[model samples]
Target: MATSTAAARREEARLAYDAFLEECPTGQLLARISDKWVGLIVSALGQAEDRSLRYSDLGRKIPGVSQKMLTQTLRSLERDGLVTRTVTPTVPVRVDYRLTDLGSSLGGLLSSVKLWAESHFDEVSAHRDTFDRATATS
Candidate 1:
C-alpha cells in the first residue's frame, strides 16, 4: 500500500508540469531544445551509429561553429543531461561526446525540423523579400 501511494504521488508530480505557465521550467527546456545549435548538434550526434564523436570531429562536421560556441553548447547540453562527455588519457588527451538516451529520443524531431527548414527555404525567402520590399516602400 505504501509503494502504491508513492507511485501515485510520483505520477501526480509528473502530471503537474505546465509549459504555458510563466514559472514553468518546461519553458526553459523548450528554449534550450529549440535553439539552432542545439538542434544541429543533437542531429549530428544522433547520426553517428555510436552516437558519439570527438570534439574536433563535431567541430568539423558542423561548419561555422566557433570553438568557443561549440564548447559552450556542449557544456550546456551536458549540464542538461542530454549529452555525456568522456575524456581519455592519452599522449594527447582525447575528449568524446555522445547523446544520452533522452537526447537520442529527440533525434527524429530535430531531423524533421531540419528537413522542414531546408524544404521551405525558398518559400520563406520569398516571403521575407516581399516583406522587405513593402517595408522599404512604406
Candidate 2:
C-alpha cells in the first residue's frame, strides 16, 4: 500500500518534467546548465587529459573570471552533483575538480556546441551584419 503510493508519486513526478515549462524540474536544470560559467567549467574539465584540474588551473584557463565568480560557479556545480570536488592535504590543501558522470554527458554536448560556434562564427557575424544593414535601410 505504502510502496504503491510512493511509486505513483514517482511516476507523477517523472511525467511532470517538461523542459518547455519554466516550473518543471527539467526547465530549472536547463537554466542551470546553460550558464556561461557552468558550460566553460564543464568544457575545461572534459578536455583535461585526466578529467580533473586544480582550482588554480581552472582560474588560469578561464580568462576574465573574477575570483568570486569562479568560486561561486564551482559551488553551484558541486551542489548540482555535476562536478565532484576533492581535497588533498598538501602544503596548501590542494583542491581539484572533476565532472561526474552526469556532467560528462553534458560536457560532451556543450563541447560540440563550442566547437560549432568556433567553426561558424564568421558566417554568423556576416549574417548579423547583413541583417543590421538591411534593417537600417528599412
Per-residue CA lDDT of model 1 for 1-138, tens digit only, reads 345688898876676667776777888899999987899999999998777999999999999999998999999999999999999999699999999998888878998899999999999999999999999999
| Candidate 2 residue pairs in backbone clash | none
In candidate 2, stretches whose alpha carbon ends up further than 4 angstroms from where it belongs are: 1-15
Measured by TM-score, the strongest candidate is 2
lDDT winner: 2
Where's the lowest-lDDT run of ten residues in candidate 1? 1-10
Question: What tens-digit string does per-residue lDDT give for candidate 2 at 13-126?
Answer: 777996776678888888888888888999999999999999999999999888899999999999999899999999999999999998899999999988998999999999
- Candidate 1 pairs with clashing backbones: none
